[model samples]
Target chain A: MQRPLDVLGSSTDKRIIIKTKSGDSIFGILKAFDSHINIWLDEASIDGEKEVKLGKVLIRGDSIVYISPEK
Target chain B: MQRPLDVLGSSTDKRIIIKTKSGDSIFGILKAFDSHINIWLDEASIDGEKEVKLGKVLIRGDSIVYISPEK
Candidate 1:
C-alpha cells in the first residue's frame, strides 16, 4: 500500500491539483515537499473560472485539503 | 514560529473543526496524531445541515484540508 508521501513522491514533476481549505483549487507541477507536507510547486496557478498564474509558490501543508494528479 | 504540528500538538484534547477535501466538516475532540497528520478523534461527528455522531475515528491526513479550534 502506498503511503500519502509515496504518492507525492511519484507525482513529482507531474501536473497536480491541490484543494485548499479556503475553497481554492490550485494547479501546478509538483516539485518538492517536506515532512510537514509544505509543498513547492512550479508554474502554479489558482484554478477557477479564470485561471490566475502564480508562477512558483510554496504552499503550507496546513492549508491544503488534498492533492491529486491532474486527470 | 509554531509549526502546523505544534499547533496540532497544542490542540490535544481540544474540540476542533476539520474541513475535508470532500467538503465535509468534522467536529471532535482531538485524541492523537502521527507525523503524517493522521488524526484520532473522540466523539467525532459530521457537522452540517444535520449533525451525525461518529464516535471515535481515525482520520486519514490526506483527506483533510485544515484543522481549527472550534469556535
Candidate 2:
C-alpha cells in the first residue's frame, strides 16, 4: 500500500502535467514535497538551460483538474 | 500504506489553505482530484453561503507557497 506522502515523494524524475483552475497547464518534474503539501516543480524547457524551479504551491487534492503520464 | 492518489483523495472535510505563487491565498474543502492533479476547492465563507467551488488548479510541488492546519 502507498501513502499520500509516498505519492508526493514518488514524483521524482517523472514528467507530470498540471492543469490549473484558471485553465493553465504546467509540465515539469516533481522535486520535493513538504509537510504543507507544498510541491517543488521543475519545469521542462527545450533550451536545456536548467530546471526552472516553480517554487512552492499549495494544492488541495480536490482542486486538481487532471494528472497524467507524460510521453 | 498511502499513495499520492490517496493523498489527493484524502482531503475530504479537511480545511485546506492554499497559497499561490502570485501571492494569493485560497481556503476551502477538498472535493476531488482527477488524473491531471486538478483540485476542486470549496472555499470557506462566513456568510453561511454554500461552498465556493474554485474549480481546478494545477500545482507543481515546487510552486507551493504554504499549507497549515486550521485553528
Q: Write model 2 residue lDDT over B1-71, tens digit each, in one string.
A: 33334444445667655545454555767666455454455554321234444544444433333333233
Could you tell me the TM-score of chain A in candidate 1?
0.90
Q: State which candidate has the highest DockQ.
A: 2
Whole-structure CA lDDT of model 2: 0.47
- After superposition, candidate 2 runs with Cα above 4 Å error: A1-71, B45-71
Q: What's the C-alpha lDDT at position A42 in model 2?
A: 44
Which lDDT tens digits does candidate 1 get at residues A1-71?
76878878888889999987767898888877777787766677776556767665555687778889987
In model 1, the number of clashes is 1
- C-alpha lDDT (0 to 100) for residue B56 of candidate 2: 48
lDDT (Cα atoms) of all candidates against the true structure: 0.76, 0.47
